[model samples]
Target chain A: MTTTTTEQTPVRGGSFEERRRRVEAAAYRIRHSALNMGEVQGQGYVGQALGAADMFAAVYADQLTYRPEDPHWEGRDRFLLSTGHYAIGHYAALAEAGIIPEAELETYGSDDSRLPMSGMSTYTPGMEISGGSLGHGLTIAVGMALGLRHRNSASRVINFLSDGELDEGSTWEAAMGAHHHQLGNLTALVDINALQADGRTDSVLRTEPVADKWAACGWHVQRVEGNDVGALLSAFDAVAAEAGLEGRPAVILCDTRIGRGVPLLETREKAHFMRIEEHEWQICREQLTNGYEGEGK
Target chain B: MTAAPTTPRLKTSAMIASFADPGQKTTPAPFGHALVKAARENENIVGLTADLGKYTDMHVFAQAFPERFFQMGMAEQLLFGAAAGMAETGLVPFASTYSVFAARRAYDFLCLDIAEPNLNVNIVGGLPGLTTGYGPSHQATEDMAIFRGMPNLTIVDPCDSVDIEQAVPQLAASDGPTYLRLLRGNVPTVLDEYDYSFELGKAKVLRGGADVVFVSSGLMTMRALDAAKELARHSVDVAVVHTPTIKPFDAATVLGEVDTDRLVITLENHTEVGGLFETVASAVVRAGLGKRIVPIALPDAFLDAGALPTLHERYGLSTARIVARTLAELG
Candidate 1:
């Protein structure tokens, strides 16, 4: 029964091109919602939201197995967000998936809003863990994976972390543990945007040779263009193919651009924790829609 | 070849052995054994450790249920983070590590992952306070203070094997996150003689006295009880109140045990600040009882590493020091 249910997951309707378009469409909506949320707060970690929207799109729209109506279903796949500041993007994806109302995006960072600026599992639906203090999501994912394996359930654990998180020794600890425990059901999605709170990720702390590091720690590693839905879909497919084998947890290192899809914000010098001018909000929205539609042609 | 042994290689492990009194009966690995018993009934109970299974006595649980045990390497943060994850998956995880690691090293993970979400993860912190002889790095002298402010986290400082054997099932049965100051490895048994049973948020008065009341928790309760018996020879009638649950503190039970006549003394295996002493004092001050309390706790300083007995005596935690303090306070 578990095998049948697990196999019946991934409800992406249509062919490969059709699936890519569908993911692109979802990613566009996520980016739009994130901008709306940022407008409500006047500022946020919007650069990260804009950058990581595609990765969130691929997971929530295609790869992840969850019941949108029932966020707390025990048998559902777990998506843990370690980079809590990315809630702008996550709330967008949750709204896109219908787990939360789309109109609620306006209340993203307000008082009494379940959708806080930082992702808190207690407040937000479908958020498995509170992820503001970076480098925690992967460790929890390893635990959820181990627990699911103990229960003999087929649920997968998808942990979304950032490149800057690699600086944390605990992330490496969980990285080794995932392979040590042979949790094939666990997959890590690393958004390598090369920018952090201080400055460039490399300038702050050289986590170069990122892919090699994950491979050295005994993970089934893959690197892809994060903004490209086709590349992400293929990497996720490759990850799924290794499920029946001895546990080798997979990590897809996605290279993303901070302030992606919005060319005006993309060229900004300080994209980490961006504070856009009030008037540019509409321009940012127009660029996103134009850039997304331009990609199809 | 290495140089010959300098200083006669110290006699026995007595200096660093378990907190057992001379000829006092003890039960070995009480925490691990009791957890194994709890897991026997509840399949959702799983054991996890950060490469300190044997040291923390979680190895016993690991042995009983190998499939259920998770070795989280030497990462305290991951050990707790994973425990929270497992708890989110509807399984209760008994994660063990040193008190230093749980309180000092992995404070964020324990706070955000387990406490913030309030998962049912029983954090068994070994070597609380002066139990270990490895000085400040290993001893969690202010563990209670470090965790007292974290909302939704229940703290339990068990006195002996009996308290542990009873508290295990209760901590597991409780719905929220809980931290247990673990007493492992031939733990002394004292509460058994008093016919005491453990409850989550309640304090039990073991013995009644007229002149002095000793308010204590954790292994210090054993020392307080022994001191009471010794003080009796000097005509000092004493009362020992064991408030094991540190948070959701049984303030009413503790308040009822106090009065205007008897002198109150707060005893605990923690630093003078942010522990039972502070809790009792806070309760008294808020209630406007105007009662004074003589705190019998480790000094607010980095402690020296040596024999457990020597450290306990030096820190006023040994029975002799407790007796001396009580006698001096009486005069």
Candidate 2:
């Protein structure tokens, strides 16, 4: 609800236990909202929503600075969602941040709804770039970072990407570009969930040693368990500690499962996208609620 | 296909600078010089290129404003993506690449990132149509045709150094995204002779004729004017109309020129199916002009790798070929 000063994130003032607990609770709500939206569509990228929930929460709830009422505020930190299909989770995160109303979650994927099936800036408030096509986010972030530095703005850019985008040559090009520009204001958070369309990520394409690849591209790299709120928060903290306007850009590669918390969906073979039966929606929510222990609302 | 008896047999490298004819008035890097002047006027303007600063004439702006110039390696997608990103942060980015790369390779990036958002990113594309002799890979023969489908993009096909210089200030001042088919590096100054003034989306009638009218754009406009002059010596009066802005075409001016029962011809450097030919013919058909339209355009095929002047003549876009096509259609 308050703005984070340039020196410290909103979570920095809180104790580690307190900060992690708040982020975990937000992640739980984010995952819960994602499941509800998925039921509306009958099938969607719900696996991605559940998988990348903690990372989104760490961004909106703890790391990023934005005014919900003023989503277009020039001073606010930017969160670019590059993989546009992750709107199920992104809508939840936006709702969680109060950038959009939580009640709007029910309108997800419906005609005339602000929340569409994919991320589009034309429809939603607080959605910076219209994304769906892969490998486009990081390059835009590089430009935004440079623009901000040119204007001498203290705002940071946090671009969200998926591991599937690593296969896109444009992503590597942007990685090289950001380092060439030495944009410390840019921070890329990659959701490394190993499931993509046509099968597991490895089978589709071998993108292992992603950290090394990013490092070779001249980025400050850190690979962590994406589902852990604490690890994710620490990565942001470490990045924040050394970031300057003229320095190497940072990338935190978070390895995550397709379906993170819900036991019923986690083991599902069709995990790239999920099609939970009407009755199974309740069970998935129950699994999420039961798995959550961050002082439930 | 056999080479025409009239077509020149010059060696490849000798005619690469075919656009800059000997002793003709010209300006070097009009696009670059104009952009530098624009950047000087507006502090928010920035220049970007995909390792094509030299080719696209963006290097002039780069040299003028090195801090604002960004060379995005040999990556077209990154160039556009970064331009859109910079636009979002309130900077006007003039991004350049070969038209083949911008129109075909990075169409999606242009569509979603710049056009969909309606950002202020100017796309200056070099080697449009048959300007290059580097075969299909470099020549952007279908640049305008491909960009015609994209909404909110203003497509400009400049005729000469004067056109590029004038269009630069206007393109930079306009709010939304635009695609400029750049005439770079020692471009001709033919339009200055007609007392021409470049308007954003308006067409100009260079000269009046009673026998035939040539509605053209790009370098084809230059050929039409030359052909019109040649046709006068043959006792035939030919009208020349230059429509540089191809997307929001000056259909009214073009259709006005086609009102007479004289033979109608559409001249362009692009294929006959799309570009200015199709635009003029489609408008004529829709307006019930009932005129039989003749086309003087490049064949809808992969063109050969050779000297520029020879390729132009072989494809019926050279001045002599235009005069020949006009007389045949008239007969």
Candidate 3:
């Protein structure tokens, strides 16, 4: 029970264009780190990491209040990755935030590395729970949010879940629970990439009317293009502005591409668990760098 | 059967009755009352239940501290996950639900979210080992077996109201995750008559005899005492050993009461496969006692729904059955 509160600089202070440039730069760095980590495995959930890079950048770079030196700070906002296999993206964000050394990105999936194949709270700093089993992170986040509210702490709980997670019954259970509790401090960040292990998310399980489903569960819903740093930042700001006021939890449905920065990997078939060929790695990096340059960052 | 009554009979089919008791002593509010007392001293103690507050006696806590009580609706997974999260923020949460739900439905959440981190979450499970007549669905006969293999979980099956009253504060004071078999509502009071107190992992020997030694837990200890009285008339001396904590079992205390010369009978309200029988058997084998042990427990099958008295008798868990089995073994 250390009651240490980390001071959070208000994310809404800077000009819109300035914030966008900074966020785009951070997202670019996160994508680079994720690509480096993927190169270590040669075969990993690299598509998801790349796809979720912007969302991660928005939170860690601007919105989340945290101490990079102290991941266990009591006042820090919790980011729970329900889809554990997306650890590459989270690790990149952590590295970008200076929570972990950028040098550690090279050891992502290596033996004895803190960055495991999946997100494990015990193994990695800033990871809230061990999430490989889908649909568990939201429930845990609900618990954490409720706990923080009971303590009268100002900390927030943001849970990251995939579209495939919407198929799990427990996810709905947690969704309803968060609303019933009126967890204003909780927000669900759903990555609706429309791709899963089997095939398309809609083909496997139709989660099309996803925004309506979250609203029906009593959550304040916001849908946005996940890879667009401007849209992502605005959605986060809106959610944070609603904190501690509305008696409803908020959910941001992020419609993202599997591989956003690199065009080569974006259109690749069966990109759920991707295996980028050795020569393709350098080309993907070059494309990502060129895209960042085109963004005028 | 006969022709149905034409006058719209009230369908009481879903209503199941508890085992009828002739004695019908005033059941004590040990668990709830003790929790209230503990919560008064420690503000971090919160109560949670998955729509079983009244059934599990959590309503008492809810009434006493409404702000601290969280009704997690009918979701067991959220019940446990929320409890874990509360523990993460340094709040000790006692989450209660039926044993079947905690052990069967939300087991994975309990394993990874609670036990893996070894959070200070106290899970109180009701309707353990045929305490209800709601059939196998409600009966948590295999709860012990399910939780035994989970790392960092401390399991306790308290015998009576007194043990529960004492065990609550002790569990709240301890730091890791614990699974306690809850005897809720009007919990029977038997341990107080023997001046028994609960120690976390220690087994207490209530009575010593020369002919047979009975190692028991939960309500079976009461039956063992009753059977001891009946066996005394036939010139049979019996010893009763009460083991409240099933995991971190007090094997030393159990084996000490075992006179290699006397018949050792392990009794429980759980299945014959993995409860006290297995724990005591392993202890005996490890000690090389070569003692012939008999396990008097429920059959390894889904139990049928019936009155508690009939179910006990039919399943060989009654006082009469215990006496008969002991006498047969002695002869």
Candidate 4:
């Protein structure tokens, strides 16, 4: 594994304001990368990629301890993408984190590209597991956590799951297992976009009182606006601090929009798998940039 | 509305009691004991079970290495998925469950999560090939067939306690995914008497003869050896070739022993399809030996729940049945 120098340093010792600014910048770049990758494919799970960009930024840019170049580093914290279709967001984050070259973003979802439409561990670097199948990442995370504990490794495991995956029984089984083993080093980040491939997540299978369900399963629960970089950073810090010491796993229920930054795409119906017109590509990018500039002002 | 009369459901406990009583005897510790020994030597070795710790003999590992043992409840998918995760973190995880669950319930997990990446996860499957009297649900008669097509997986069907003890350390030392058929709790001892040592993909000739040869695996090898002795009384000599490693099958050894004049029989506790029978027959056909090859294996159907002796006799897996089949084939 080649070791690449990280462009951004850890947020430790920085002021809360400074850390929030850095995280917001990282999230901004991640969203930009997602838009660029989406333009390459024209139609994909671009909505999911855009919505979860902030969460991915929080994990890769702020919380995760990893070498951008050396993804197979034994001591690095693992981030598993359970919802494999969210690879667009993860690829964006990877590019921003220097794990993958930002220039390679154009090759996403293309033939002979390392960045496939779905996240496959065999195809891409920094991908911990191949996960298109829902409800498998959390269980794998539980196992990784147990193994790390047995080896006395301080590495943490963070699994990214979607709201639609909550319907799988294996997810709950892993939830019970995480608590049963007292794996404090494990954390689950749920992207509750309220949409799935079938239809609305709730309509497909209601998973309301989500925070309560996790809490009942003995997890340290935190519900926050996933698009808010500051809230995501705080939630991660709290969970990281309590992990291993609390003897309980952690979960953050992130309520996020399907398409977050671009105003034109945010309210689009059936945005689960967005297909923008060829001419609308430049317009989407303009909306994203304009929105980011307005937020900054 | 009139209430319909419902048929009484058969009680599982009553069904269990009707099976022949497994007589109490001194049974040696099987895979779990060997695993404990290996775990003591290697800190990275861990044990996991899907609510079958006691039944699968993983309780022994749990007691020995309390901190390293993981009980994943009854979820077979989680059991295998977690084992793959453990393997990712540089741990040699021996994940055990009933063969039926591992092959049928959690096969996708094993295929994608474990076997796809070729992780160092040892999946120990208990109740292989009619070891249990609980009917088709527990009997893994077709497990070998289910896992045969999977790539990067080494399948092992140990003959007895001695073979299992030897295979455990080898499995730990091996770096890829493996599926081991397990015989738990007071497992029968057979290979030790023949001074047998397990080599990963090699077949050992337990006994050599000229008239007929039995290519066998699992406890069926022990039955073949017993049948060979019975054949000796009828002035017929039989050779026994034990092929414990099923996937990377030792075809050379099997073909080396084959002759056009002698009858070659492939016997296994599993179904004939995609098991030892298919493996040996395919190799023989490829070699164009033109030898008469006979397959004496279990039927590719759900077996009836009964005593071990009765099930063995019905399926032609018993020593007596094997001897009779060999004689009938010879005549």
Candidate 5:
């Protein structure tokens, strides 16, 4: 696959066409990085990583503003990964953000590398919270948002969660607390690929009417095709504008596909986790290069 | 059918006023007072309780920082999990619940979310061991054994109000996670003889003796001190070593005092099987210090409900039992 420097895009909130192109390019970068991460690990949650590539790309590339050199900057927006096993996605995103060397992606899950299968906050730069136990990010994000608002800072907090991670009751408690405090500066992007390890999330524990759940809890809700770079960019911009308006929090439901770009893996029922062999790896690389139209969700 | 005893008279001295001003008519005021002071100094500090603010004396923090305090409402697991979240966001969260719940109900979350991740969460657990007379249900008799096995968790068994007040900021400023056993509601005002400086993972020698070392922690340390004073009447030389930090056990301090000639008796208000007795015994054995060790702790049985003083005596956690144990072990 080639690394293309697409023309800089801005949305009409700045430049729509330019923003879409840059977002597509970012998706391509995250997908390639995730592939490299999975290859080094021999097996991983590559399917979910690939699925959430667009949302991750949209955030690191366009939404969040920060200096790669200063990850601990007080003013930088905080990004928390609640589904820790999906750290391969974050590894890809961090590489794109230049917090970690893009080449370090190949050392993922290696004996001596900093990248582990599960995310560790101290081990990884750009990880504001070390998340492994599910259902913890929203509460932490609430605290950071509260602190930031207290200090009169304009920085926002974005928490990335999996549909499956919502099974943790503590997550809902945090969601309730977030709305109760009217933390408008906090936005939670649920990468609703509808799959979790061991089986489909719905079959195991259905979290359907998910948007209504957030709305009923007092969050200003939005839904979008997560893989559509344009939609994701619009969703983020809309949420940012709505934040702190009458003190209502925001929840963007990103309806996404598992194993998004890879045709065979995208339809696989067990794509919650992937154990791709070397031959499968070649097929994935070829399919990504082909640049087929976005597949089924 | 008997009526519960009316409120006991407030029988404490002037030095204890710093600890008993929280309307509880007790010396446990310093625990909440210290937390309130720490919160005032550190704006990022927050307090949480599982319907235990009044019992743990964390109400002082609630009163001082009403917006920052979270009332978790009887859920111990949620209390720790939320505090872990608060800590992740760079907020110093001091969570208070009963020791039984913090050690038992929330053990997995405490070990995984807070300790394993090494978050700077301070868990202040009240009604530890035999401090209350509410029977086995309220007694946190085995908390030490339960928490000692968790990795990266610091365990503190404060002896009195002074130790608690001094240890609050010390634990909060230090990095990583800690579980502090609380002696709330009229905690004995002992340990005044010493300067009350508490170092993490360090044990202090309150009084030295040549015949026996009464190794203990928490409220039992006060009881042992009282026993030591009484033993002096019989000319029985008994030393007292107070180990506040249960985890990261001070092996050097423990071994420094252990000898074949002198007996080592561990006194605690906790269970004999898994609390201070087992901890000190394992440390002594692992360090190859084969002193005659006698454990002076509650017997392996569930205690029935009664008055606090009656229960302490029944469980053999009273000062008389400590003195008797030390004398018997010396023989």
Candidate 6:
């Protein structure tokens, strides 16, 4: 019998390292673009976009498998943005992926642009589902996961939902549906920034012990510091391992801060739509540039 | 009633399709048959019910595809929400429950998730209007009016078994989302006059008369046809347009049929406001048709229910009542 050698193992050194660096740079570009686009639009939900940058970085960089040239490739992994207001963040990621032109990022929330404040699946490419109303995306994610399972494909479905959305009754229903179906290929990334438009989520509906809730719902839950690249990668690896086990769906409760890197915006009570002073643009741009350089490969 | 040896309805040149020659079945059985067949054709097609699969005749689909069928266990709100999710994944889901529960209990989910985004889910409602003996809780007299206001939803209230049979494949074949009011199990064979070549959005004109036009939809079309036969006894000629697609009404066809002086009667098995009657009346006025339009529909109230036949007459929706109302308005 011919022995298969260890040489068949795909090495994770040269191109993979370069891809990681490129993705980090892409994440920086997305954050830079989102901040600028939010400014141009007069106002937007920039805090959520700012906080989700690093988590977005790792998925696009090393975890997800897709060819940017063909956004609709059947074999590509699907990314569903459940919180519609965070189209600001999703648009940045799609632009980084070359699904949309980078220049189009400036047109967010504009009258004629395909990029609306809340995402509409019909108008935009790579927008897997229409989501504006809270607690809607998980159900669609369950459906897509079931579809992939039916097709017998390994392509994973990732649904990004906000902590604020967890208050919705439908979200829990979707959580019940996903685990009951035994969708091992599904992964839910909860952007737990602890802030809604009104106030902090704890002050609002208070989804205390969120991880416990997901655990009780039968999902294999993992808590991660969302902004750390190492933590994100580790969480993804664990999720992949669980998928290999073929037992249950997974949720990564990503702890993050609202207005993550920007000092002035971070201190604001309502970071949803940060209105920067004309002179403060330099400060925001400087912070993003420095943060990108420190994380640059 | 026994069939006469010599036909009174029509003396056909072709061999008469006998009603009693040991070959005829008065009730339409094709609705239950097609649902089971459709389930076998597509494995992705899932069946959902809120404690009502057998009563609605969706048990046929359930029996054929047990693995895909999900009995939502009396939670109608979750029933629609889950079905909407299933539709998002490219699955063709047929959700069946009572018309009232869907129209009232789960209106929010139906409007927000399924209708607003336009997911391709099929809603099959059983005992539409006054089709059941069960009282106010079961009688969905105002279902059509309730769903008519929701945008991006295609509403099809099939009159009989033929429409139900044809609607299953047609709704599955169509791209956008739809809500079909079902008349399941021993459904009356009302629209057998046509071979059931029904289109999704187009109205089918069943009879021709220039004197009076009866624009009706759903089960009320059966009453309209019966009334047409009765009105002809007094030499008061009438035309009947059986329109099933209520949302995107065939306004042009309805306006064209009603002459400037001829009276138009709009009938339905739902509340007068926001139902088919108001829908047709609005279209007639908008199309610049100056014909006098009268609405014959259930009043805006919780309907008291008995047997379907009794309730239909009690609420002035019967054939005799329709004829009397038409003559009273026209006379």
Pairs of residues clashing in candidate 3: none
lDDT of 2 by residue, A30-137 (tens): 999999999888888999999999999999888888777889988888899999999889999999988899999999999999999999999999999998998899
Best-to-worst order by DockQ is: 2, 1, 4, 3, 5, 6
Candidate 1 residue pairs in clash (backbone atoms < 3 Å): A84-A131
Each candidate's iRMS in angstroms?
A: 0.7, 0.6, 0.9, 0.6, 3.0, 2.7
For model 5, the docking class works out as acceptable
lDDT of 6 by residue, B21-50 (tens): 123334644555786777667666778887
Per-model RMSD to reference: 3.1, 2.6, 3.4, 4.6, 5.4, 7.6
Off by over 4 Å in 3: A1-13, B1-21, B24-26
lDDT winner: 1
Give candidate 1 regions above 4 Å deviation. Answer: A1-13, B1-16
lDDT of 1 at A2: 33
Going through the candidates in order, their DockQ values are 0.82, 0.83, 0.72, 0.73, 0.27, 0.24
CAPRI level of candidate 2 = high
**lDDT tens digits, residues B1-331, model 2?**
6868585577555312556667878888888899989888999999999987887888888888999998899998899999999999999999998899999999989999999999999998888899878789987888888999899999898899889989999999999999998888889898988878999999999899998988889988888888899999999998889999987878899999998888888888888768888888888899998888888888889999888877887888888888887778778
TM-score of chain A of each: 0.95, 0.94, 0.95, 0.95, 0.92, 0.90
User: What TM-score, to 2 decimal places, does chain A of model 1 have?
Assistant: 0.95
In DockQ, how does model 4 score against the reference complex?
0.73
lDDT of 3 by residue, B1-331 (tens): 6898777532212323333256745365567888898999999999999999988888889999999999999999989988888888889999999999999999999999999888999999988997877788898999998998999999999877788989999999988999999887667677777857889989999888888999999889888988998999999999999998998889999999874688899999899988889989988889988888999999999998866776888899999999999999888
Comparing candidate 1 with candidate 6, which one achieves the higher lDDT? 1
lDDT of 6 by residue, A1-297 (tens): 012222321112245446556556666777888888887876787878888987777766566666566666667677888898889988898887667888888899989889999987776887877788777777667767776666566778888999998998767877877777788888999999988878778899999899999999999999999877667777888887875476688999999887777766777676555666677766887887886676544
Segments of candidate 4 deviating more than 4 angstroms: A1-13, A241-244, B1-27, B289-292
lDDT of 4 at B314: 85
| TM-score of candidate 5 relative to the true fold | 0.88
lDDT of 3 by residue, A86-137 (tens): 9999999998887889998888889999999988988998788889888888
Off by over 4 Å in 6: A1-25, A294-297, B1-30, B39-46, B67-89, B104-119, B132-139, B149-151, B194-196, B209-211, B233-235, B305-310
Q: What lDDT tens digits, residue by residue, belong to model 1 across residues A1-297?
A: 133243435456578888888888999999999898898899998899888988999998887777777888777778889999899999999988878999988998899999998899989988888998988899889899998988989888999999989999989989999989899999999999998889988799999899999999999999999999999999988898874375799999999988999999889886677989999999999999999888763
The recovered share of true contacts, given per candidate in order, is 0.77, 0.75, 0.72, 0.77, 0.20, 0.30
TM-score against native, each model: 0.96, 0.96, 0.94, 0.93, 0.88, 0.87
